[model samples]
Target chain A: MKMAEKRPLDDTELDGLFAAARSTGPEPSGDLLARIMGDADAKTAAVTRVSRPEAGRDVVRARPGLLATLLGLIGGWPAAAGLMTATVAGLAIGLATPDTLDDLTGGVLTSVTGYELEDFMPSYGDLLEEG
Target chain B: MALDALTDVSDEALLIAFGNGDAGAARALTLRLTPRVLGFASRMLGGDRAEAEDVAQEAMLRLWKVAGEWRQGEAKVTTWLYRVVSNLCTDRLRKARGVGIDQIPEPEDDAASAETGLQDKARAAALQGALDELPERQRQAVILRHIEGMANPDIAVVMDIGVEAVESLTARGKRALAAKLAGRRVELGYEDG
Candidate 1:
């Protein structure tokens, strides 16, 4: 609701107005409750960085696609999204992976790598000749 | 380690135990928090229950991962959770601006009896619509204050704002909310507090 005139309502008055409005509104239940909570939970899960910079920027600012740059070139910084899709995409890709060790199971790094079972067996020619 | 101890313990305590590789503490904390966090997420995202649940689960997982590093008195566990959830919502909601809520399976029957359950469902649906119209900050403030019954100071801390600012936001937000629902009081069938 738009106020036609500049209303100098006290804080208490404003509180009452809001309370009355909200009271009259419906109470959430059933699926809706599930829905809101689900959103909140998903949000919490995804929040990686807890503290933000006071300067209102993350330590790094992501660069958007050329379109964003073009927009910036033509207009100004206002054209850029607060978060660049490229940067978040890159970060997400980065976080999803960690360093891995070489496959010891498939390679000679295994303890048995230097020796072959076949080679350890006495050769038939040597055995027969010795006999 | 015991159920009683875990139940009585604060989230922070359980987290510390989890850090030390206490499986029981991890289970207890997840079970204790999952439902409430799920509920909060559902409400904040305007009936997107499935997405909300996903968000909650992810948030909980992250919380578990960071349990060891958590410092005492940095923030209340629950408040920290709410703040985290809100930020996630902001990110996803922005992405989902034009996207409709994905279709998800709904249970026809649950604990409630049929007739009253139907009525409750209608009421809940109505409430969700009105809530959707609220500004993000107002909706969050309302949910924390009225639904979660958090103190002003705690809300402020979670919101990353001053006490006075919290008061003003809540007040203005609630007034707008009240104005929005002026005529629906009788339908909701609850006396105004």
Candidate 2:
């Protein structure tokens, strides 16, 4: 005997068939769930482990190293350069002051007395003869 | 707070989170998607429970691998999954070389009245036996549209066909199913109703 119609059934008949088919479908087993969840956890853990080092790198960069700490203490590179320049300028001024003042005085004395300091002072030869 | 917030997140967002190493999102997605995949695979593979489980696992594995590259708005997660299950089922069917309901084992169900449950099983089995007789595309269309209760457009996405084409395939499939099952109507208890 024929099992089905020569024509397809209408919507209502179709719904009944669909419902029967849906009800009879198999469910996922407990072992299947365990296996899938196990796989998901493994993958997630692998991703977590892979990301930890990157987070570690960010932490490492955040904390200053010895050279960075030293530079920071000196108020950075610009301040260090400025300090070096000021120290050198002070040393140069200090070393040149006496010579500059002596030159100025000798010139003035020579103009007023018509002689330099050397003219008023005994020569090395006169000192040797007296001795 | 974060878990609560994640509970309302869309599947697309959950996948992005999973890609970014959020274990909670991964768990949420597994819970949401795996059963659907198994059910669809079980139906498509003609109720071979073990093979269905394998296909579901493999499809989910692919989803996890591609989560990093899954473009939102390109396709819905459910859409992509149905397509994947369809392709996997097609591949298995091809490899099985025309194996039909003769190879289909009885489904195991535990939560129904004895008389009604046996009748439902018999009806479902008869329908499955008829479904195995249709062309693969028609079978896929019929299963997605009728048994799975998907919209025509979504079925189109899964089948990679136009909505019109999906309509045509499912129409033809249902006709074939009706013809095959027409003889069993009385025996299957649809005659009284």
Every model's TM-score:
0.55, 0.70
Which tens-of-lDDT digit does each residue in B123-178 have in candidate 1?
A: 55545555667888888887777666689999998789998888888777667655
How does model 2 fare in lDDT? 0.80
State the iRMSD of every prediction, in order shown.
Answer: 9.6, 2.4
RMSD of each: 26.4, 12.2
lDDT tens per residue, model 2, B2-37: 556667789999988888777788778877788788
On DockQ, the leading prediction is 2
Q: What is the lDDT, from 0 to 100, of the residue B121 in candidate 1?
A: 57
Model 2 pairs in collision: A2-B183, A3-B181, A3-B182, A3-B183, A4-B181, A4-B182, A4-B183
Give Cα-based local distance difference scores for all models: 0.63, 0.80
How far residue A36's Cα lies from its native spot in candidate 2, in Å, is 0.9
Off by over 4 Å in 1: A1-131, B100-111, B114-120, B190-193
List, residue by residue over A17-61, the lDDT tens digit for candidate 2. 678888777777778777877877777777788778988999877
Candidate 1 structure quality by residue, lDDT tens digits, A15-111: 4433433333333344543443344344344433343352246435665778767877757555355446667876875575432322523433334
